[model samples]
Target chain A: MNIRGLSLETIPPIFTPFRFFLSAPLSGILAAILLIYSGTDIWLTRWNINNLALTHLLTIGFMLIVMLGALYQFIPVMTGQLIPGSKKLASSIHIMISLGVLTLVTGFLSHSRIFFILALFFLGIGLCLFAGSLLPLLIARLQNQLIVFLLRILYLVLMVTLGLGLYMLLAHAVPSLEIDFRNYTDLHVLWGLAGWIVLIIMAISSQVIPMFYVTPEFSRNYLKMLSLAILITLVSLSLYQGGYIKALEVLLTLELLIFVVYTLHLIGQRKRKIADVTIYFFRLSLVSLLVGIIIWWLGRYLAQQTFYFLLAIVMIYGLAISAITGMLHKIAAFLIFLHLQKLSLSRPTAISLVPNMKQVISSQNSWIQFMLFLLSYAFILVSVFFPQLTVLAGVFMLLSFSWLAYCLFQAIRRYQKIQLEILALPEMKMSI
Target chain B: MAREIILDVSELEPPQPFEEVLKQLRKLQAGEYIKMLHRKQPLPLIQLLHENGYAVSMSNSPSGLWEIIIWKMSDPVSAADCNTQFGTNIIQADVSSNR
Candidate 1:
């Protein structure tokens, strides 16, 4: 149990978390771009097998892939332990997951059962490999209360979602399986969104937000209670979808209230009082989340198609994308800083190793993206009922996401350049 | 007259632990200065000290060891000082520096 002596070559403890950092936001960007191009006019009509393909493109391609990578990186840091798997195993899992997402999306779009089955097999295998690789690290470092709890819940939700996904895919191929795809799909989305993604984000944010911004620590009791409440609501809603609607509504409202209060508290207490673009992004995201909840609640009561579309746009494009974009700016800068700091320690060179955080992501471009996203989101909300303005919103969304993707690419390129510079240092020649 | 307090932190576990040493040094001798020799970048620790009220000067030795010189501040006492002053487990002062 000598954590310090763990070979750095065996997938740097941070590598897994870094993977999530890269994959998650990029997945959102990709999904947004795809949806924009496909035209916003199409309503739930888009929720067919083809749209399922698009869904996986976001969920599996973007969400799970990023989550897996994050788990790899963050788990070790949290537990003060390293993953037991080799780098090759991690690479294989990445490849399999990527291929599986592509294949699954294509299968859903083409209505090809063979490809559908193949997609399930590949994705399932990839997930299993990932889980297997991470299990030891998770088990070994069960002492870290916050991280261990988050990791365990994340893995459980992932397993349930993946199992349900596989079952649904198989049922599509062979209808005699007696499994209800609709129920399973709904449960999968709930678990994936609420149970896995949100829980982990909350857990990590409780630690990182204070550390990064030099804010006071959040109340541990409040955080623990919120986590449990969210988990219980998600499980209850899954089991009793119809009966638990009122309860779910109350719980969701409570959760959002807690989040808003906590986020505002953190921002208010932040030591760095400078105007940060990332903080602005977070503000926009919180607003979007509020709008989304209102839309969902309205949709349930009014039965309006407009409310439904607005809810989707707010949640998927608005809150999700905004938070992701904001995080990418920080994560990219932080990783580069970490890598350079490691190098600077090893090699005492006069090289200006640290890249200014502001330089990593263009504030102007991010603000532009934020404005465009908001505009497009508003237009889409209007177009859902009007229908004629759909093409205009679609165009705006296309431009906004494209610009976001470009910004991300530039940031990554800058990071890569820094990496190359560090690698080129004569005294610090070690494989990354 | 300028006096140099040498701290051989070759055996220091990590940056955080090393900072504990800095804190103790700051407390034991208020006016005397420090020139830390360590095999790792002590910039973070230096920055921490600076933020906490100590004025620091940093340089690199020819043999790749980092040298950080910290000077005590000549100012009114602050709240952070009270905490650090009374904090018993802040640093392992018993672990004698090899220098």
Candidate 2:
């Protein structure tokens, strides 16, 4: 593949990704509201209707939304080709998935067959549309790179997970399906979380952490081999469930351990050391993974729901959310800075001052959000045991997401105001 | 005599390299050229330069630095002449008419 063909010319408009990013925090806020409304029942078990609703809200509504947006922007950087019809495709997918997730959440909370049917139609169609647009791009131009290999595996796993999810939804919608729901749920969750979510994070970091931070590049040889190792372990785990391949499981644990250590080392080695909030988010994610992995490993011996609950909390709120938040900070600032620089070039006299990354989105604002995020995370952790503290956690979560949405909305507004100023210039009539 | 501006961009991250190079390009004059050294080829920057009546010759040297020597459309010292100075991957895009 001619990777160079994937340049800025091929990149979609900034608004394509921004739309998805702006919607993400609202979903987080919704999840928090669901938690608050569910009250004590949410703590009963992972299978609790409210618990399922909250998890889907975070997983589908927040993380997947952010990931899709990131991919629309990053794919050009990676592959030198844009997904075809990016803006329209993104807008349509966003609408379908957003509404689909809402319906799915309602289905879970109310246990209504009609809601389940609507969710099945919406989410299944929305996700499949995303896959339909994305898969061909990867297959045609992504070549044999390690990221591509892993992405292929990730996409396949996502499809399987989605398929199982639809099957379960159908089973709920139609009672005579005779499908084994319990066992399938285990596979679906594992594939969705571990296979797709965790693996994509690890793979993207192998490139991003180095390039974005000016840190040491991850060992190329290890990176080259890691995709296959992760794929094999996932497949093995799928087959074994909790049985043989103890060695494979051990290897998976080792891989995660290396991630924690490497992230710490990378942060220490960063070229610009005057504290950034994104670094804190990265550290939070890595530490959460370490803690989550340890709790999960220990769960093998304890066989208790508390360990699993803590693990889920750390995974969803701590690791996944933190990672997305960190990446979002950088991506948002970079894209804004880029477009501003472009405008500066196009209308040099009209736009004399282009904002730098920090000016676009202040570090202080991000820190405020980060602190709120941490407070909410702490509350959620405590609520895992206390159950009643969920209300407090929910309140903090609402504040955190509201702050994030406001910051992003303000940045985009700033971008637009500058754009209008540039366009209003009499000299800018012909050039750009 | 031709004027040469050298920018060392190896330590910077991402679009900074792209941005700094463009900022410098705005100051370019007739018979002047820029020599930018970065860790990776600034592909978008190269595209921008091509469209703005500038030509670029990029090389990944044995020392692991990308040297992009850029000159005006009228410059007699072509990107081909600079290709012999570096080790691998020479990219020369001439779009002076588009300017």
Candidate 3:
């Protein structure tokens, strides 16, 4: 009832999130390039260096970067709390993370022991700083709030994921370390994918889908228990990985099935009947989630390595990437539009008119980007079956990301141009 | 006398308030004004109204309900030309609520 989050007067500076948003697509383009040049051989086994490099490039480089930015931007919106830091801290965090991701990918591809160690150092410091920035705000308001509690858990799991990853890299680089990397592999991957990524998505979806899409709110009874359910599932799944209880896997799968179904139902009930590209992205993401889980479930009976690899691909690329892409397009455009609107209010009679969100980032451009992404996704799915199609998939990925980058860049450019035009007016000083 | 269109969009989730407000704005007559009750300021809605030559003044109550009255520029009783005290009260109320 306070409608505190809706009040934007105290939110962080625009560049804080915008810098991350702008950098994300470049990482996507890099991932596509890695896929193309690494060739079909890289697609055969998920354990290959190229495969590992490409996955991180997409997951850490693109998805995590965007999520980090969104967290910085939306946490304030969600909690009605200010992010603790100056604008300088935000920029530094962005730089550290970007550098960390770049170095980590380079280490994976080059097989340099020092690079791997440097990767750990950079990534560890950056992630810790990032988490520290949000921890205070989250800690202050976590009482009796399910979604924020889930987000807090997500951050905890992310730290665990990063720790396990560093240890794995350490073991690999120094065989004398005597760490069992294999023992931690599945746990590391699941905690990162299911714990951090999916949990954050669930938290955001619960708030956003209803708010943005004008859908019936998700069942309060079910949602209230979701964070606890997910936490229990993750803990149980970790124990199950250590051969403690087989039944936990079933519980985890059941939780996911319920989540996917509930999300689909909410999407179905959305009242807005418009040709929204963001909605299409959400549909693609939700469907991919279902498909990924089914593939994961089949791995118990099939026992095929390819199925496991395919499951990872479908989950990370198909599900996670698709979901974030939808979020990125919507959030980026909305923030720009919101800021421009607020700025324009100062000079009421200015000759320059502020552009609406749709006008700034045209629906037609987004649709084209979506179509390219869809085609690329289909090709990637096909490539999983016929490895020879990986290059074609790579090409499509390149085109899709290039188009995406172009659209985002164009929107940013438009925002800046309008800002400059508005500022040029002598009346702007009066409004501020 | 033109009647006021009262829209209580506080119960309706986000963007629905946004969408509904925009829709109602289209149907607004020259002499008519809308008294919209919402939980939030609905900044985007306010912006669109501004762009379309409408004037809006909103006040937030201590109970957290926001009352937004919007009228076209040409309207006799538009916020722009209303009793200065009415506008002053809304602004003072908004400031006090924030405090």
Candidate 4:
């Protein structure tokens, strides 16, 4: 593939992506706080309002929001097509989604139809604008079949998730619909978690691991086959309920296992054996994936719903959060430095003002956060089995996310500071 | 004869490759150009070159290697001379002036 065809011309302003990155940890902070306030009761069952609120807090507020940010960033790099009116689109999308998530979380907590109504309106318009905006661009790009394929599915499943989500919201908003929320709940989680989130993880990791880590590129045909397998299994999973389909039973776990092995192997073989913090996060993510599988496997044998709770904890807190944090460390640092570098270029005197990658977020600071994250993960895992210690887990989680927000904020703060100094220079000949 | 500093960063990762080029560009004098051999297109590096008052010539060799030749546009070089010496893969060889 002519990867260079991916142009920098379309890169949205630094704030466009940074705003989303910055918001993720804030969402994590809220999730952590909720985990604390909800207490051990959340560990009892997945359907409880407290647990549901916590789930959306992480899923929609944290994970999906970051993914949405990445969508804006990646579309330009992958396809070389700029969103025609990105600034306004991004601003509006950000506001709507922010409101939508707030209302949705409030709806869950209060069990209020009004909040649900407001959430559906906000998210519906927000998600539709997001989907509507992206659809045209992805359809136009045909160069790299793999990326185009991944992006198209990401769009489709997002809409699918949105549709199911809206339908569920309607059931809540209009009580006369008599919709059995329980029946669709399984399908909703399956599509949202596996089809949308996991596949996106697959799509992104396949490229990033190789490119960023200097690992061997995963075989194209192999990845295509893997993606196809995921698609087929997701369809089978939703359709077949009479008897558990073998592929459906095994595919999600099997795919994750394969991914873990594949990624670990690639990381092991990377050209530079550097002891970087991002590498540490990736390792933690892989290890978390393994633990998640183990927890899930153990869930099958347990009569108590505690194991299910453990599995979710391992997946969300341990796996998803670890990977997202790692990627953010690199991405936030890169974009900040790149923008600084660009700004510093106009005046040669400003060259010295630009911070190196490490200086943006020190290895020491990131390491501290990483360790805290691991500690938080450990406590969360233990809390599932030992509910009394749940408060402590929430503290660790809060500390970790707060540190994360700080570190991300530092990079942005530094960027703004340096950018101001550069702009103040006399005879500034260029502008981004 | 023109001066050339040939540096190969095929084995280095990320900011390393970009940093190596910046280091060369720092002490570079008039009529002296840096020819960098990299494994992939340094997109960020290219963007920096575009932003800064620098002239850049990037040619992807048939072996899937990238040979990037850049110099300060203030200290100009002739495109005709560069094209003859650097082979045919040069895309947007802004050697004579800035964009």
Query: Residue A377 CA error for candidate 1 (Å)?
Result: 3.5
- Candidate 2 lDDT, A1-432, residue by residue in tens: 222333434345789899999999889889888877877777887788888888889988998898888888876555555676676688899988998899999998889889988888888888888999987777775532656666676677678777888888888877788777887887787677666667667766766787777887676566546655766777888888455767777887887677678767876897867677887888888888888888877887754777768878888889889888878877898888777666665565754667788888899898998999899899989988888888888889888888888888898999998878767756432232
Fnat for every candidate: 0.00, 0.16, 0.07, 0.23
TM-scores of chain B alone in all candidate structures, in the order given: 0.59, 0.71, 0.74, 0.76
Clashing residue pairs in candidate 4 are none
Write one digit per residue (lDDT tens) for candidate 4, span B1-99: 458888998877777787678777777776677889987666556656766666566766777678888766565453344555753544442243211
Model 3 residue B99 lDDT?
11
The stretch of ten residues in a row with the least summed lDDT in candidate 4 chain B is B90-99
Off by over 4 Å in 4: A1-8, A142-145, A242-244, A428-432, B1-5, B27-35, B53-60, B69-76, B83-99
Model 4, position A341, has a per-residue lDDT of 74
lDDT of 2 at A327: 80
What is candidate 4's lDDT per residue for A1-432, written digit by digit as tens?
Answer: 443344445457898887888887888898899999978987878888888888888888888888888877766555655564677798788879888888999999999999999998998888888888877777775455776787777777777777888889888878798998778877787677667766776677775776678877676677777777777788788788766775566767898788789878988999887788888887887887788777666777875578667767777776777888888888888878878776766676887888988899988988998899889989988888888989899999999989999999988999898899988876465321
lDDT of 2: 0.76
Question: What DockQ would candidate 1 receive versus the native complex?
Answer: 0.05
What tens-digit string does per-residue lDDT give for candidate 1 at A1-432? 112222212225335455555555455555555555555536555365544655677667765665566555544444534465634677788878887887787787677878878887888788788878777766663444665666666677678778888888788777678767876766776676556656645665665565555566677667767777777777778777586689786887779777866777786877667666777767776777677667666676754655545665666556655666566666655555555545543343513664655566667776787787678777877777766776687667667666666776676677677767766776632111
Docking quality of model 3: it rates as incorrect
Per-residue CA lDDT of model 1 for B22-81, tens digit only, reads 345535453355566654444344433543445554445687555555555543232235
Off by over 4 Å in 3: A1-8, A142-146, A172-176, A240-244, A300-303, A428-432, B1-35, B39-99
Of the candidates numbered 2 and 3, which has the greater lDDT value?
A: 2
Q: Count the backbone clashes (under 3 Å) in each candidate.
A: 9, 2, 0, 0
Q: Taking the tens digit of each residue's C-alpha lDDT, what string does model 3 give over A25-67? A: 8888998998899878776666788888888888788888888
Instruction: Tell me the docking grade of candidate 1.
Output: incorrect
Off by over 4 Å in 1: A1-33, A44-46, A141-143, A176-178, A241-245, A418-432, B1-99
